[model samples]
Target: MATTAITRFAHEEIKPKIGSRILNSKEELLAGDLGPQIRELLEQSGVLVFPKIDFNDDEQIAFTKTLGTFAPEMQDGTNHKIHKITLDVKENPQSAEYLKGSLYWHIDGTMNDTPILASLLSCKVKATWGGNTGFCNTYAAYDALSDEQKAEYEKLRVIHSVWATVFYYEPEPSLAKIQGMQRIGENELPLVWNHKSGRKSLVLGCTAHRVLDVTPMRSAEILVGLREWATQEEFSYSHDWSVGDLVIWDNTGTMHRAEAYDPTCNRMMHRTKLQGEEPFE
Candidate 1:
């Protein structure tokens, strides 16, 4: 029988339950064939932070590909493998307006059955004040639930709508704007996602418009309560960025939101992703 090799990189836990810091050089991370180990770490830790690794666009893209399929970002009717994450219209014109939704807690690709597998963000410019990204480990949150709560939630379903997210920032949207966002569509997902790996996670987020077969008021209460519980200090991590820092989170098992900040303060991030491997089931 062959024995598996032990992982060699240095690591530090960011929190007891949710996050970790990878203490390895950019060169080693980019060159080492550590995808399996890294993916396992991501599943276990939920979030990984690389302090001041300073990877540029090409390097970031290369690093993303090392893990799995590279998910390209669509901009200006073109596919750009690396996306510039900024609220500045000059830098990311097409995506800037849509990014307002990032201010609220949400999972990416809620409109699709399968969201991106993971997101890798490298800091280009740190915010002048309050731009730390917040993440919550849904897996940890679900695991922390009481047996009765888990059993009850496991049977519920939710309606996740792209248009609903628009209302978070724009309470009263114009008919045309509503129609446009509606065209992007919505998906009905389980309140609890049962992963192929046998772990479970909550699928609640801002995009979760309502719980099906439940009263509107009840839906609101349930969703809001679950979100609050999941985001409590124990299961969440808020990253204070330093220029050149990189952060990665498992999109399938976590909810993330951008902390409020000055859009014009020139806070910038470069983002890359791994294509989704499992659909929400």
Candidate 2:
């Protein structure tokens, strides 16, 4: 397995194939011209953990821009770079219900042709129990597939829909709720994303509604089977959160899910995203 080559900051690999922990002071990270180095490290290690760096919203936004284009969270005509990650209706009324689907393994922005490059999530209120974010390196997973498996998968396509994700969390939903999710739409994407960087990653996730040109049973078998394979312990990492912890993961190369936690705990996180530079092909 390729190892992370980040020499500027004192760092340790979290796992052989997936994560890296950066041991650097918050000031150095913000003041230095480390964008290129950090980006390289991010690609090498799909997930980067900054233990208790404790960045507030302004600092997080500033840090996000240093790395790449900052994707502001545009909601209800309000443009804000920091998004509140929470399930509490009173705190995040707009996305509380939607976040329930986050419990399942999935990639974000599957409906969009180009998903965000990376997401920076800093914990503000840690969960009392559970709620460790789980991540799987899809790029590593794809590389480990047998040549025969890779060859066969390369020819397949998938239909991904937001409504499918809703159904996973809300088995029996009202027609109105279904209509809302349906309006977010579905996208047809290749089973294997042939990235510009010449690396391939599996696009399987909960949003993967069905495999095109395959029987329903076969599609289920393929999707579920691949998800299991990609998430094997060797290629996955589950991060335990602290109040000041911040994490960034390559959205284009990883599949992630939220571990179960108390709904009323009010675990909060502030997030910022980097705009995607390439489309999933």
Tens digits of per-residue lDDT, candidate 2, 30-72, equal: 8656778789989888999999999988999988988999999
- Give RMSD (Å) of candidate 2 vs. truth: 4.4
- Candidate 2 whole-model C-alpha lDDT, 0 to 1: 0.92
Cα lDDT computed for each candidate against the true fold: 0.93, 0.92
Clash totals for all candidate models: 0, 0
**Residue-level error in angstroms, candidate 1, position 195:** 0.2
- How well does candidate 2 score on lDDT at residue 164? 89
Q: For every candidate structure, what is the RMSD over all alpha carbons to the true structure, in angstroms?
A: 2.5, 4.4
The stretch of ten residues in a row with the least summed lDDT in candidate 2 is 2-11
Off by over 4 Å in 1: 1-7
